[model samples]
Every structure is written in structure tokens, then in C-alpha cells.
Target: MNDEINYTNNPLHGLGLQELLTQIVDHYGFEILYAYLNINCFKTNPSIESSVKFLKKTEWAREKVEIFYLYQYKNLPRVSSEQFELPPRKRIIPEGQTPREPAELSFEDAERVREKQAKKAAEHGKSKRYKEREFENLWKR
Candidate 1:
């Protein structure tokens, strides 16, 4: 039994159109690639298929695509062995820093607010009675 060449488990293998576009973008500026590819996707939201179609048909566009592929491979960001972690920073306060004073509502003010709320509720009840009169007429109809 012969083991066939696996396309899946390979470096820089099975590169999809979107991935190819993204990699090319990361390496070369969008404007340069747009000029090179002459594809609408590169210029004004041209799709991968449209770009691929243009490139496949035109040799110049195909050359640009090859150049982009090479650029992407060369300038790929190296995977760092060292993991990046944010340093545990201690928030420092000045030596003479004072805490804010606690806010407390006075009993007289509280009572006044309660009385105002009761007055609003009574007003609301009066308005509600008028609305109920309309509903009673509707029910009769």
C-alpha cells in the first residue's frame, strides 16, 4: 500500500483564497497589490474569486500574485517562544492622599422627598381615573 502525499499536514500548504489575500495584505500595502493585481477586490472590495479569475486570465496579474505569495512567505511574523504577559503593576497613591467623604441624606430631606413622591402618586392616580373613564365608555360600546 502506497501512502499518498497528504496536502493537509504540510507547511504553507492548502492556502485558501481569503488566507492568501490576508497574507499578501500583511506583507504588501493594499494599494501596491491593487495596482499589481488590477482586480476590483484589491481596489474596491473585489472578491478572491474575481481576483483569481483576473490573475488566471492575465499573465501580469498572475506574476503579481506570485510576487505576493513570495512576499507573504518571506515576511511572515515569527512565532515567539516566549509568552507575552502583562506585568503586575501596583497602583501607587500619594503619602498624604485622603479618602472621599461618605455621602448621607439627612432625615428632614428624606421626609420632604417622600412627601413629594406621595404628591406625584396622587397626581398620577387622578390622571389614571380619567383614562379609566375612557376605557369604561369603550367597554360599554
Candidate 2:
């Protein structure tokens, strides 16, 4: 079976690093980028060429810029504390849409939700403890 990854929903797919830098620079300009990223490329004699060079060499700085693009510029829905953390590829894209407000829950529904969360937490703790034990056993061998 042939499987292909579809990037239709991904905002960062077609865009190159240079293009990303240029778009961000066009939208926010170098001074604002400098304020947000606080990188030397944006602060000192800033240019698209220089910033791209810096971002290419620095992984952390590149991630920051990409995150800024996703959250600030693209305005994707903010991740909720309760939801499982997802990587960029796994996250749902909002495509310029406003985030929907969470629905109000009744007392019973709220209690149920809390119980569910506690159960999930307990399960996660068990798995973590099991992994630690496994690692300890491996070291003893």
C-alpha cells in the first residue's frame, strides 16, 4: 500500500525559509521582529538576507520565528491546558477563523469532566512509573 502525506492543511508546507522571513519582515518589519525575537540578525543591520542566514544556522531562533508566525501572524487557536499537546503537523489549523468559546457546563457535567481528567492523569502516572521501573531493571541486568 502506498501512503502519501497531505500538507493541504499545513500553513508552513509550501513556504521556504527565505519566503517565511520575507513575509514576516513585510508584515511586521525588522524592528518589530527584533523586539519579538531579540535576535542579532534583526537588531543589527537587519536584512532579509542576513536574517535568513542567521535563522538557517540557528535551530532555536528558527523555531521561535515559526512559532511567532503560527501564533501571532496566523492567529491559530491557542492550545488549551486540558488538551493533549500536539506537534505542528498533528494540530488542527483554524485557517483565519476565530476560536469558538467553550460551552458552559452544568454541575453534573463539570463533575464528570473532572472525574475523567483525574482518571486520565492516574493512567498516565501509572505508565510513567512502569517505564521508570523498566529502566531500573535494564540497568541492574
Candidate 3:
């Protein structure tokens, strides 16, 4: 009979809103925890201690806190992996157009590409693009 109200055999034994909020804040900083929860407690001008008091009175806030705890901390059933995996779709390449396979880049080819990129970056850096732009602005002043 007691099982009807609570989770498992102990419905009356769940942690309240304050407890859940405290745990979340302890794990993640107050700012981040508040951002994710999006409750008035964290958003209010007062600090976490004060916010806890305000949150305790609000039934809706308490419910959300409890739900998040139950879902994440309490090991609730997860959605099936199948939900994330996309179904296979047909690839349609035009018959007349040849689909070019990617060029097999050897180790030498990769090293050459890297060296070229490094040289390009060095040239760009030496150009002092920022200094050029700042000089124009400074002269305009």
C-alpha cells in the first residue's frame, strides 16, 4: 500500500527540492546549475542560500527540481539507442557524373601540405595585419 505513493518501496523517502538543488550546485557551480535549471531561485538577486528559501515555497519549482534529480541522479530508464541512430538512406549519384574517390594522400603528401600551411601562416603573421588596421584607425583619430 505504501509503495503506491513513492518510488519503489519507499515513496516517502525521496530527497526534497532543497536537497536536489544543493546537490546540483555542489556538483556544478551556482551559475551553471541555475542556467541549466532556469529557476527563479538562482536568477533572483539574492545568493544561493537565499534562493534555496524561495525555491522551497514554490511547488512548481520543487517539482522540476525533483524531476531532474529523478531523471539524472536517480538512474531513471534511458531512451533507447535506436532513437539516435539514423536509418539507412539511399545515395543517389548521377549515372553520367563519375563520383571521384578521394585522392590517396601519402605520408609525404601530408608532410608537404603541413609545411605549405605553416609557411602560409608565417607569411600572414609577418604581414602584421592587425598593426596595419590599427594604424589606419589611429591616423583617422
Per-prediction TM-score, please?
A: 0.31, 0.56, 0.42
Identify the superior model by TM-score, candidate 1 or candidate 2: 2
Cα lDDT, model 2, residue 109:
44
Residues 6-123, model 1: lDDT tens digits: 2222223455545766665655546655543344657876666676666557654554454334323332222212311111011111233332222222445435544554566566
Candidate 2 TM-score, C-alpha based = 0.56
Compared with the true structure, the alpha-carbon lDDT of candidate 1 equals 0.41
Q: Choose 1 or 3, whichever is better by TM-score.
A: 3
Model 2 per-residue lDDT at 74: 62
Of candidate 1, the 10-residue stretch with the lowest lDDT total is 83-92
Best candidate according to lDDT = 2
Stretches off by above 4 angstroms in model 2 are 1-6, 80-141
User: What TM-score does candidate 3 get on C-alpha atoms?
Assistant: 0.42
Off by over 4 Å in 3: 4-12, 45-48, 78-141
- Clashing residue pairs in candidate 3 (N, C-alpha, C atoms within 3 angstroms): 6-11
Clashes of 2: 0
Which rank order by TM-score, best down to worst? 2, 3, 1
Cα misplacement distance, residue 36 of candidate 1 (Å):
5.6
Q: Which segments of candidate 1 are over 4 A away from where they belong?
A: 1-12, 26-29, 35-41, 76-141
